[model samples]
Target: MSFLLRLTSRLTGRQVGTDRFGNVYFESRRLQPIYNRPRRWAIYARGGREPTVVPPEWHAWLHHTVAEPLPEQKRYPWQQEHRPNLTGTPESYRPAGHDYVGGTRRVTGGDYEAWTPGA
Candidate 1:
């Protein structure tokens, strides 16, 4: 976070809510002429500011897709916990046969064989 952003957020932002991960959500105190509506933002709790860290409910709220924030009582038994995207990280998933996994895909014998032209 830069000094200017911190100052702007402190002066114009109002704390709206905090997520389970401790990330703080905020909205502009008043509508801005540039946006014509109160802008929303979130400060990441973790060292890296990964957008995926924001849960689906908060994400929807931040993008104005929902009028109200997620309610605690609305959660269901099947709702899965949020997990940060690990696409390019060391902890990312690699299925079997992946070089990183040190596994080779098994080649099963089949009836079909490659045919060369004029062979």
Candidate 2:
């Protein structure tokens, strides 16, 4: 965390809860003059600050989408565990022919040609 964020967090934040991943959630103890509502925020448990690190339940609460945070036991058996988004990371999904994976796409035999404007 930067000096400013650390300072701001200390000055205005109150711990609301922590998620299973160790991400700590907070809300402003009092509304500040700059905003219409008290602010809510989170500090990432992992070194990276990926938003995906937050579970679905916490995501809803953080955005005020739900009135209350999800209870630990409320999750259904069919539901999968939460995982952070990994679009650009090494762990991200890559199709079979992706360049980064050292795979080459099969070339199709020439069956058509591009049309020239005046041809």
Candidate 3:
């Protein structure tokens, strides 16, 4: 995959920018086809769900809101860092900083205990 990207990049003369999640972004050197929006220069990236994994700096660049890619510029001090959205995975969106969720709630809806009449 890297080889193909490197080859394409070489042919186009655009450098690859590696984001925080190992995703790569590139700008077109030839402006071959702009079918998506037709007016803006198309920016591309190799990514999966939740583009936040790309980090704030790269996110700006990926959307063409910024001109330069990461490693060249930096995140602001007040800007919070990136953490992949983990809503479904075992290791995702947990209360603690670390540790995976085991998916077992201690109390179930039907298992409530009734109070005794005279305790």
How close is each model in CA RMSD to the real structure? 2.3, 2.7, 7.4
TM-score of 1: 0.80
Instruction: Sort by lDDT, best first.
Output: 1, 2, 3
Reference-based TM-score of each model: 0.80, 0.76, 0.47
The residue-level lDDT of candidate 1 at 4 comes to 76
lDDT of each: 0.84, 0.82, 0.55
Tens-place lDDT per residue, model 1, 26-49, is: 898888797688889988887456
Give the winner by lDDT: 1 or 3: 1
* Stretches of candidate 2 exceeding 4 Å from the true structure: 2-11, 33-35, 74-78
In model 3, which runs have C-alpha deviations exceeding 4 angstroms?
19-23, 32-50, 70-80, 94-119
Cα deviation of 116, candidate 2, in Å: 3.4
Report how far off residue 7 is in candidate 1 (Å): 2.8
Q: What lDDT tens digits, residue by residue, belong to model 2 across residues 50-75?
A: 78798887888888788678877666
